[model samples]
Target: MIKKFLLTMCLLAALAVGGFLYVKQSVTDFIAQPLKIEQPHLVTVERGNNLNTIISKFVDDQWINPTQFSTLVRRFHPNLTQIKVGTFEVLPGMTFEQALNTIINGKEYQLAITFIEGSTFKEWREQFKQAEYLEHETDGLTEAEIARQLGIEHDKLEGLFLAETYHYSVGDSDLDILKRAHRKLDVILEQSWASRQDKLPLKNSYEALILASIIEKETSVPSERERVAAVFVNRLNKRMRLQTDPTVIYGMGDRYDGNIRKKDLREATPYNTYVIDGLPPTPIAMPGKASILAAMNPENSNYLYFVASGTGGHVFSKNLRDHNRAVQQYLRQLRSKK
Candidate 1:
């Protein structure tokens, strides 16, 4: 009877070991199963989501079997159960274990949106409407209301945001990006103003922003920014009307059909520098760092006027006579091209 009891105990121990190995192998196989992915897509693991809930999402979506993949995380890979909150780019051919590891330890995918230099706030808003994975909370809000929310008392919002590439995750808002740009512009503008050259005609950082916006619209060549700034600065010191075409365009608003007419220039508008004596009511466009720096410290030159050279640069002049000649030259070049 004792010998019979010993044999029965050995049989029970063997069956237990066999059950443990079968479970371990099953978990390994399920973890190695290829994830179901037909096309690339974005997946967001929201806050307070656990591994079971996440796996259930896959199961509900028919991407995996509930019974085949559930026990693997808790029984074998306990670390994968500590899933993180992020947006991930799930691609084709990833295994179940790889996807979990990506959610747990891999870096979240980042998308970028760029605000081009010389763009207006309206243009930026239009871009916000079209951006993917970004929340549009500022839609339908007026500029004044938006400013109040951003803690700004400024009358207008143009040229407030810096022109640069900003990165964000799936859940970020347009206001979040705007706030960062505004803060950065504030810091940069303050630093530039504090170290500005003495005797500048600009009264404050706002005026610098206004001038910088014009400079940004005037030239795209990197080498021409300082010289272009000098012409505007010299005109400001001489009390000459800015007579800039961009200001006329801005004043016309939707009436501007990509062409500036003499009648449009003759019209008296607050933003039309040809009619106004000083900088416009606000900045007309977003200016970059170099343009801001140029506005703060212009090159020391006698230039008072400039005209586009048709070759992607400008012909600067110190007097009306030379400026008129350059204008005539530019007209001739246009005629020759035509």
Candidate 2:
């Protein structure tokens, strides 16, 4: 009777050992096998999704063998029932283990969009419209309604969103991106406004933003920003017409045929700083951080006029007579080039 009992125990132990060895080999083989994907596959694990759902999704997509994958997960990572919510990219020829690890680690597949400085709000909207991954919530909303939706109380929406490259996951809302940029602008505007010099003609931070946008449109050179800002500041202090061609072009709208004519300047519009006093109603384009800083801290200069120096920068002057001379020089340079 003792021999029979010992024999039974040995047989049971052998079966257990055989089962363990088989499972170990199966797990190893499953993990080592590459996923069947010709192109990169995107797997989105939403919140509240379980391992079963993930496995089913992969199986349905034919990314993995359902039976083998289930066995491997059950034996190796039984506690990994829920994957973190994110979109993971499973590249072609990656091993099953590699793809699974990427999903488990929640490495999101990020998309990027850039808003260029000096680009108008219209251009910004066009970019948002073209972004494939962004969910368009504010597409049909009016500009004012869009501002309200973004939690901004401003009457104007132009130059409100900061220019920067923003990263987002798939299915992220465009409104969310706009909100982030707006908040960034708010933070930067406040910090810059707090550090501004005393007794400036600007009424508020928004006015500074407007000036910054003008400066941004004026020049791309880093060294020229403060000088150009100083020109505008000097003009504002003297209650002189900004007479900036950019403002005139902005006011001319469809009438501006790639050139600023005498009529365009003479035509009265709210945006035409030549006709209206002080800053325009709103910013004409998005301003970068450098422009914003330059607007707040303009160089101490008596200069009131600027014309393109033909070297991708501007030449500033203290009076209209000098400005006219600089303009003549600019014309001579243009004629020479032609």
Note the Cα lDDT for every prediction shown: 0.89, 0.87
Measured on C-alpha atoms, candidate 1 has an lDDT of 0.89
lDDT of 2 by residue, 1-338 (tens): 99999999999999999997888777677667788889987888888887778777877888876565364666576655547788888899898777877888756999999999998877888999999778999888888889888878876698998999999999999999998999999999999999998888899999999999999998999999999999999889988988887888877776768988777788889999878999999999899999999999999999999999998888889988999999999999999998
RMSD of 2: 2.4
Q: Residue by residue across 123-194, what tens digits does model 1's lDDT show? A: 999999999999998999999989988998795899999999999999899999999999999988999999
Compute each candidate's TM-score over C-alphas: 0.96, 0.91
Error of 2 at 43 (Å): 1.3
- Model 1: runs farther than 4 Å from truth? 1-4
Task: Give the CA lDDT, 0 to 100, for residue 122 in model 1.
Answer: 94
Among these predictions, the greatest lDDT belongs to 1
